[model samples]
Target: MRLHRGGRLRWPTIGLAAVVGIGVLWHGRAAPALPTAEVKTGELVDFVELRGEVKAVKSVTLNAPSSTDGDLQIISILKNGTGVKTGENVVQLDTVKLQRTREQQQSDLKRAEAEIEGAQAQARLQEEQNRTELMQARYDVERARLDVQKQEILSAIEAGKTKLRLATAEQRAREAEQKLRSGRAAAAADIESKKQKRAKALFEVQRAQRGIESMTLKAPVDGMVTILPNWRGRFFGANAPEFKEGDRVWPGAPLVELPDLSAVRVAARVDEAERGQLSLGQTAVVRVDAVPDKEFTGTVSDISALAKIDFSTWPPPKNFDLALRVAQSDPRLRPGMSATARVAIDRVPGALLIPVAASFQKGGRTVSYVLRGARFEERTIEIARRNREQIAVARGLRAGEKVALRDPTEEASRR
Candidate 1:
C-alpha cells in the first residue's frame, strides 16, 4: 500500500526509494577505467618525446635526364617495389626519337663537312682565276708601254695612239687587281661560314648521342625499387599512377627511388619554441608504426638553420625541420610511416618516476591519488623533474606505490 500524496512515507518505503535512486544513478553512469601505474625506482631521464614520421636517410629519387632534348615516353619500367641491384636499369625511355635525331644530326654533320670541302675547292679555283687575270692584265700593260716607247721614234699621231693604249692597259691592270682582292675576301668569308655550320652540326650530333644514352635510367644502389609518381601528371589525386611503361615524362621528372633501407631516418618538425632544446648528436629512440615491436636508435643528424612558418594555425607559428639518422637500419623501416621518438637530454640517478596523468592541480598544489588499501589517499607531490609523459617526484611519493592515472576526486564527484 502507498501513502497519501500529502502524507510522509514510512521508513521501509523511504528505504526502498533510496535504494532505487542509488541503483538508477549507478546504472546510468558506467565506471570509468582506472588506468593505474606504479612509481618505479629507476634513473629519471629528462627527455623530450615527440611524435614524428619515419623516413629513409637516403630516399634518393631517379629522375629523367635533365639534358634531354624534349619529353621522353617510357618504353619499359620496373614494377613498383621491385628489388634491384646497383647499376640495374629501372626505367627505359623511348629512344626512337633520340636515335632518329642522332642520325639526322650525323647526316647534317656529313653534309656540312662536304659543303666545307666544296667551298674550299671553289675558293682555290677562284683564287687561281683571279691571279691569272691580274697577271695577264699586267703583261698587257707592259706590252703597251713597250709600244709607246717604240712610238717615241715615230710621228706625233702614232706616239699619241701608243700613249693612249698604254694608259688603257694600265687602267685594266688596276681593275683586275681590285677584283682579285675582293674575290679572295669573299671566298674566305664563304669558307668560314661553311666551317661554322659544320661546328653547329657536330655539337648537335654529340648532344643527341648523349640524350640517347641517358634514356635508360639506372639504380645507383642495391635496394628495392619504388616507382615514383609522374611529375608531369596531376591527373590522379591520391591514386596517381607511378611512372610506368608508356608514360610520357619530361626531363628531370622523378621516376623511381632506390631507398637505402640499411640506413634510415625520421624526419620531423617541432614548433619553434623547442628549437633551442635540440642540437646535433643527441641520441633519439624511434618507434615506427610499421615495425611496432622494434625500437630504432638514431642521432640528430641535421637541424634546419631557419624556421618555417606553419600557416595551419593563427599567429602562424614557426616550426623547425630536423632529421634523425638511424644508426642501424632495419628491413621493416620504410619512409612515410608514423613514428614516436624520445630524446634524452639529461638524467638523474635513483629517482622515482610516475605517469604524468597521475598528478592533479588542487588548491594551487600538485597532488596525486595514491591507492592505499581499498581507497585512494590524496597527497601533495613535489616534482623534481617533468617531461611530456612522465614526472619525477622528489617527495610525497615512494617506489612500489600504485597511483591513479586520472583524477580520483572527479570520479568520486561523478559517482
Candidate 2:
C-alpha cells in the first residue's frame, strides 16, 4: 500500500510542472505588439509661427500748431471723431483777446494811414514849394538872360568903350542856370520820399492781418477732429492726455489720429531668432482671437529693417516687427485685434512622410520603428523637412512602408 501511494504523488508533481511550462510559452506568444502606421509619399510643409496684433496700414496723428499757447482759451469744441471738411473750424480759441488785439491793430493801422496822408501832404507841399522856387529861379534866369542880352547889345554899342560891363552880365547868367538845376533835383527827391512812406504803411497792415488769421484754428485736411489732452493735467482731468475737449496744447502736439480705412494691415512682432526665416511676399495663415472660427489669408507686406528696443518701464527687450496685408478686405476688421500667424518656410513635394509621433531620437540620429513581418525593427531615417504635424523622411523610408506610431512595449516583454 505504501509503494502505491508514492507512485500517485510523483505523477501529480510531474503533471503540474508540464502545465507551468506550457502556460509561459502561451503567454509569450499572446503579448500585444507596438502600435504602428504606414509611411507614404506625400506633400509636407515647414512653417514658423508668430504672435502679432492687427493695426491700420495708414494712421496719422494730428498735432497742435507750434504757435499755440496755454493762454489761448478754447471758445468752442467740436465733438470728438466728427468728420470735418477742409478749412472747417475744429477748435476756436478765445478770439476775444485776438479780436481786441486786431481792433487795436486796426486803430494803429488807421493812425499809420493818417500819418502816411500827412507825410504825402508834406511831400506835396515840399514839391510845390520846390516847383514854385524853381519857376521863380527860371524867371530870374530869363530876366538875367534878357539883361545879359541888353548888356551884350550895350557892350557891342559901347564895344569901343568898356570890357568890364560884358564880364558882369555873363557871370549873372551862369549863376541863374545853376539855381534852376538844384531846384529840379530837390523836387524829384521829395516825390520819392512820399512813395516810400506809403509802402511802409501797407506792410504794417498785412502783418496785422496775419496775426488775426493765426488766432482762428482751422482743419488742415478733410478728416475727423480728435482733441488731445493738455500736458499740465489742468484741462482734461488727471488721466493721461489721450483725448478730450478744451485741452490746452502747444504747437505740433499730436491731437488726433486719422486712419485711411481703404487700406488695412496686421502688424505683428516676430521673435528675433526667427526673423531671418521671414521675407516679404511670403504667404501666411492668420487667425484673430476675437473671431477664432474664421481664418484669413495674408501676405507679408513689409518688415522692419531694424529691431525694436524697449524704452519703457519694461526694459532691455528686443523684437522684430512685421506687417502683413489681408488677402481680402473685411469691413469687420478693426485695429488692435490679437492674431496668430504661420508662415511657410519651405515645402517638399512627393516625399515619404510619417507622423511625428512615430519618430524617435536614438544614437544622435532620428529613427522610426519599421514593422517587419510580425515584429517592429528600428531604422535610422534622414529627415529632410519637418513641421509640428509631420516629418518628411529623406532616406531609410519608402512608399507604403509600415512604421510604428507608438513606442514598443512588447519588446520589453520579449526580452
Q: What is the C-alpha lDDT of each candidate?
A: 0.84, 0.69
lDDT (0-100) at residue 302 of candidate 2? 88
Q: Count the backbone clashes (under 3 Å) in each candidate.
A: 0, 5
| lDDT per residue (tens digit) for residues 5-117 in model 2 | 46968988899999998987755453246666788888787788877777667765555545534455455667665777778776655556556655666676677667657
Q: What are the root-mean-square deviations of the candidates from the true structure over C-alphas?
A: 8.5, 8.8
Q: Which candidate's lDDT is highest?
A: 1
Query: Best-fitting candidate, measured by TM-score?
Result: 1
Model 2 misplacement above 4 A: 1-63, 66-81, 85-87, 90-108, 142-241, 287-294, 334-341, 346-415
Model 1 error, position 242 (Å) = 6.0
Estimate the overall C-alpha local distance difference test score of candidate 1: 0.84
